[model samples]
Structures are given as structure tokens and as C-alpha cells.
Target: MGDEVKLFGMWASAFSRRVELALKLKGIQYEYIEEDLSNKSDLLLKNNPVHKKVPVLVHNGNSIAESLVILEYIDETWKVNPILPQDPYARAMARFWGRFIDEKVIGTLHRAIIFEGKEQEENIKEVHKELKLLENEVKGKDFFGGDTIGYVDIVAQVVAFWVELLQEIGGLELLTKDKFSFLYEWIGKLQNIEAVNECRPPREKHLEYIRALVENAKSGSK
Candidate 1:
């Protein structure tokens, strides 16, 4: 394959990791450029001028920003190990859920993790409300993609891993096995995938980073 694939991303970002997982799942070889988000790179800024975020995928000199967009591009560009479903409606649902997770679930989950007392309680309630929808979605399936990991599963990396650690730091009980058993089981299945598992940030390093964030939030509140 003469195609050139490159990913600009931050190590700790779940958004960045999803792109990595897509590339890995598709068996695509590419260069990984680790970006320092504190000091934005000229290339990242140029490629993704609007968002100026990490996880800009450059293929053969064409840049694609946004994790969900990049995943679809990867799936379409490389025919191997299809990320989205073959059925058009299923694919649309995958995209829909992927967007819902990013727009609705993730931010609320983060708020649930950082805020304390009443705010945190309210955010936690909101998270449970959103996740119950997901829990119901995954009730009878091994994954959102049915048996195999697909677009929705890849997009849900945050739900599978980071939130658990965030809950630990915040002393929240958001995703307990009893409450979201199917979603909990789905998380396990995603974690067990070697391709996806390898793309995750190191557990200890990730925990340390999140702990520092919580500390910073606490200090800022004072």
C-alpha cells in the first residue's frame, strides 16, 4: 500500500486513542506523532484550524479532524477489518450512538467525576440517566456492534475505561455492575480486544493525570 497514514494525538486523550484503535483494527500502518496540547504544533493547528485539537488523521496529505469522522474515513479507505457495519441503517445507528456518546455522555460523565456534593450528585444522576439508555441499547448484545467491536464500540472507549477511574477518584458509583451489567460486560469485552487494549493510555499514568486534574479542580474551587 502506497497510502501514507499519520495520526497527531495526545497520549492521554480518549479521542486520540479511538483513532489509534481504528487504525490498529484495520491493520493500517502509520506514523504516530505525539502532540503537546499545552503548546500546539503548527501542523496540528494547520490541519485542524477550526478545532485545533489532537487526533487529526492525515492520509496521503489530506487531513481529517474529529475522531468520529476519522474513524469513518479509515473504514472507507481501508477495506480490511470493517469498523462500521455493512448494513446502511446499522451504520447510521452506529454514527448516531457515536455522536450521542461524545456529545451527551462523555461531558456529563466528566462533570460527574470532578464536581463535589450537590453538583456532583446532580451530574451523577444525569450520567445514570444517559447511561441507562446505553445500558438498554446493549442489553442483548455483546457489543454495540453486535458480536464484533465496531464504530460505536470504538467510539465508546471513554465509557469502557476512563470513567471507571474517574469514578474511583471522585468516590462516585456511576457504572456499577448491578446497575449496568450489560454495559459493564460490554466494557470487559472491549478491554479484552488486544488491538483496542493496546491503544489505551497506561493505567497508572492515566490515573495520576486524572488525580492531578481533580486536585486542580479542588484548588480552583477554593
Candidate 2:
């Protein structure tokens, strides 16, 4: 086995897609293992005892968990078409924006779309604030990394995709052309990339899945 690489992932998970996109960008070959969240596989639990989450990278029998961590690992191991910037300051900036999207934007969107009542209102406001910051960050830049599709760009793209889905499900469009011109432009630029285009799931299918999840969540809460 010459550097056999395997990825355990769920089809709809943003985290899994992030890892998949990174691997494809770097031209790394890997086997894809689809895991069911309802009935997680034994191998997945064994590989990631702590989280038991998807997007686990298994390289030559060594397993790594967490999507962001796995992306860095793939970049380091492959070293071709570098994802993170080489410059220290630029790398820091990229990492900062990545974390911002993961923690602030995505986290808020999850709450706003899935939950109800006052909590949803608070989360919606928080998400709006985060989106404004992201819009400012993308001003005058083709990509989040400024003219290159790098780590920050990857994180931004993932967040944008899920945000669109959430907005559709919640019947509230937050990032429109008028409100977030820079972010709207940034998302268009990101979608034009061959790597991003190839890995994206169909919008109709994604929306249907989100609608079902939202309905299920509402029923559970009632």
C-alpha cells in the first residue's frame, strides 16, 4: 500500500466537503467511505473515539479527525498547490477568517435556521453581524486570500453554501446583492472555480434535504 488514503464522510456535511475539496485541490487520491450519522460505523468510532465525526482522514493506516485539522495535514503532506499562505502574517489572516466563519457565521446560522422563538432572533442578529464582517473582509479581493483561492477562500465557500441553504429553509434571505455586494461577488468568484464547481451538490437536492431537516427539528421541539 503506497500511501493509501481514505476519507470517512457524510454526503451532506460541510465538514466532509471541506476535506474533499482540499484533497481534490491538491490532486491527492483517496477512497471515500460514506458514514450514516444515525448508525455510525464501528471503524469511524474507532478512528475518532472522541468526536466520532465524519471527514476522518486515514492515510496509510494513520487516522486524523476534524475537517480543518485534516485540511492542514493534507497540505503539509502533499506540499503541492499550497492551500495556506507561506507568509506568516498572511497565514495568520487566513486562519483568522477561517476560524471566524467556522465559529461565528456557521454557528449562528445553525441556531437561527434550526431553532425557534427568541433564540432564533438572537442568532439571526449575530449571523447578520458576522456576514457584514465577512463582506468587509472580501472587499476589493477576488478571493478571501486576495487574488488566490486558499484556506480562507475554502472556509468562506463552505459557509456561503450552507448560509444559502439555511436562508431558503428559514424563508429569510440575509445576504442579498444590495446588502452584501462584496460577499455576493466573492461567492460568484468562488463558484466559478473548477474545484468548487465540481464538488458542489445540486441546489435542489440540498434544499430538499434542508427542508426535511427543518421540519424534523420543529416536530421534535413541539
Candidate 3:
């Protein structure tokens, strides 16, 4: 029997983007189900009972949650274009960088939007520092792993678009080419790829969505 593949995701989710890119890279055909995060679907909650989060990949009636875990599953299921490296040590490095980007870079950037004054200033510093570490990693390569996109590339993709959008909308300067030269250039390279570009959320709509988040936070506090 053919596998029934479906993806539960939100348009503006960077985590969702990771799963989409992995499927695209492997040339897998699957249904894309967009979820309204505020009012999540029963399907989403049922599939991902633990976190009630997105980027859940349903294949042959089996559901996989969490973006990183889903990426590994996708790569293992369909090996046409490998997302991970073959060597055990090399694979370990790729996994390390992926976790680093999520824990350090993404969290710090979110903090920049959430906190203010002293807290925001600290977050901004941490973001720059984390980005600097990533910049050094990509100093002499086309991407995190190599010339082509891989697991680490997908994980680091938030910087490919999210950082730029946040900077424009929030009037914050982060991930500038002047500072993170290779890392900044790397974003443009990743964006230029047809697969990555196709899955990217439309900029105008995404801006509005993110702005609403900030506005809602402001209103809630007041």
C-alpha cells in the first residue's frame, strides 16, 4: 500500500519550514494542512498530544512530531537526497549545529521581540554572539554542511528570512552583512534556491502576521 503522507503546519512557523524543506528536498508529495495556532485543529492536537505543536508528519497512519525528529524520519524513509551526512561523526556534527541554532539563535531572537529595556538589550547581545558563532562556522563553506542544503541548513533557515523580516518590522538591526558577512551572504544564497524560495511564506503576508503578534502582546500588557 502507498503511504498516505500529510503535514500539519502553520504558514508562519519556522519549525514548519524545516519540515517542508526536508520533504521538498526528498521530492516527497504530501498534503499540506495549515493550522490556526490560536484555535488548533483536533487533528493537530490528536497527532501531537504532547506539545500540541505543528510540523507533524503523518505517513501511513503514523504521526511524527517535532521538526528535528521529523527531518530525520523523512531522511530515513526516503533516501533520494540525504539530509544528513553518512559518517557517524559527521552526522553528529550536523545534529549539534542544528540544535545550537534552535536553542541559541531562535530563542534569543524571540526574546528580542518579547522582552524590553534591560532584558531586550541582553537578548540582543546574545543574538549577535550566537550569530557570530554561526558566521564563523560558515566562513569557508557554501552552507553548514557543504555546498548543498542539508539538515543544518534547514535548521538554520530561520535566519534566511525570519531575521530580515523581524528587523524590518521591529526597527531592529540584526544579522547585518557588515557584522556577519558570510552568514548574511549565506541567507541570500539559501533564499535564491528554488526549493527554499517556493516554501517561504510570502513576505507581505508574513510581515502582517508577525506585526499582529507584537501588537497583541502590547495590548495584552496594557
Candidate 4:
């Protein structure tokens, strides 16, 4: 009858949440399939045989792996509420910041939380460096999109939401208001968006999961 849009995602994954936010913003009705990463499903395996990762989008039996690719596909395909900017240069800038967040910010912040001794300190410094770049980008803007949550903001859900929760459970500090004032406020703004807010995992349960991860990291380190 209509487009068969389906998303395979893990609840606590920020990457999966990005796809969900994009879909919601574009008013695209789709079925969301929750994935158990530990023991992935046959469909998920078949869809994303390469990486075997969650956040695989299946549109009319065609599967697309990777969250960034899925976001672009959704935006291009739907074209209702544009997740990315219209201008050529603006869209490029959005993609740039999104890539920067994925490559530099997310991994560094996670390592900063999970590592100990000299490694943790180094990762924390890297986190600050990476966030300062984002802080500069968000300067004089309400959101990364400069009025609403757009692609960069959606991609940075890890920085906005998960980092805060991880920081709380990990007993570490990276995204501080004093250091990155704009990003702190940006986090508040991003979380306030109805669509973005709706895609988040329950805070308590997520914290519990993060705590387990931290404990496991500690055990493995020893």
C-alpha cells in the first residue's frame, strides 16, 4: 500500500536514535525493530552482513547499513521536514560537523570515560579539544542548525544526551558548563525538542546499562 520502511536499532545506541530522530522529523511512519546486539537477529544479520551492526534501515526490502547513510537517505527520500540544510555550502558544513562528531567527539568521550590512568587523562583532554571546536560552531546559535535541531544536532545526540548520562555513571567530567557553555545550553535545547526527546532511552535503565559497561571495562583492565 505504502512505502515499507523499517529500522533495526538498539534502544541505547545514539546512532540508532539519530535515524529515529530523522524519520520522526520528516513525519515518516515506519516500523521500528529493537535489536539485541549480543545475539543479533537473522534479519539484522542478513540486512547488514558486513558489519552486523544495529541501525540497519530496510526500505521496501532494500537494506541500508550505517546510521549516517540512513539519515541522508531518509532526508532525500522524504523531503518533507528537511533534516539537512538546503544550501549547497550549508549542507556540506552540516555533513562536516556530523562527521567530526562521529569521528572525533563520540569515541574520544567514550574512551575518556572507560579508560583509566594516563589513558583516561589523555582522552579527557582530547574530549575538551574536540568539544571546543563544536562550541565554536554553536556560538551565536540556538542549535547546530541555528534555529532548530538539524543534521549536526541529530548526529550529536551522543554528546547531548548519552555523554551526560555516561558522565554521571562513570564519575567523570568532560562536558562542563564552565568549559563549553554553548554546548551545555545546546544540550538543553536539543533535549527540549519533542522529536529528539521522544527518541531517547529511559534515563534510569540507560544509566544502569552504562554502569555495567564501566564495571566490565574496569574488570577487563585489571
Task: List runs of model 4 lying over 4 Å from the truth.
Answer: none
Please provide, for model 1 over 84-171, each residue's C-alpha lDDT reduced to its tens digit, 9 standing for 90 to 100.
9999999899899999999999889877766778998999999999999988888899888888888998888888898889878887
Query: How many clashes does each candidate structure show, in the order listed?
Result: 0, 0, 0, 0
Query: Would you list the C-alpha lDDT of every candidate in the order shown?
Result: 0.90, 0.84, 0.88, 0.89
Q: How far off is residue 181 in model 4, in Å? A: 1.3
In model 4, what lDDT does residue 171 have?
A: 78
Candidate 3: the clashing residue pairs are none
Model 3's number of clashes is: 0
TM for candidate 1 is 0.95
Q: For residues 1-222, what per-residue lDDT tens digits would candidate 2 score against the true structure?
A: 578999999888888888888988999898999999999999999999999889899999999998878888988899999999989998888788888888777767777887778988888888878889888888998887777788877777766687788787788766778888888888888888898877777889988987898889778877
Tell me the deviation in Å of residue 222 in model 2: 4.6
Best by TM-score: 4
TM-score of each: 0.95, 0.93, 0.95, 0.96
Q: Rank the candidates by lDDT, best first.
A: 1, 4, 3, 2
Where does candidate 1 clash, by residue pair?
Answer: none
lDDT against true structure, model 4: 0.89
Locate the minimum summed-lDDT window of 10 residues in model 1.
Answer: 108-117
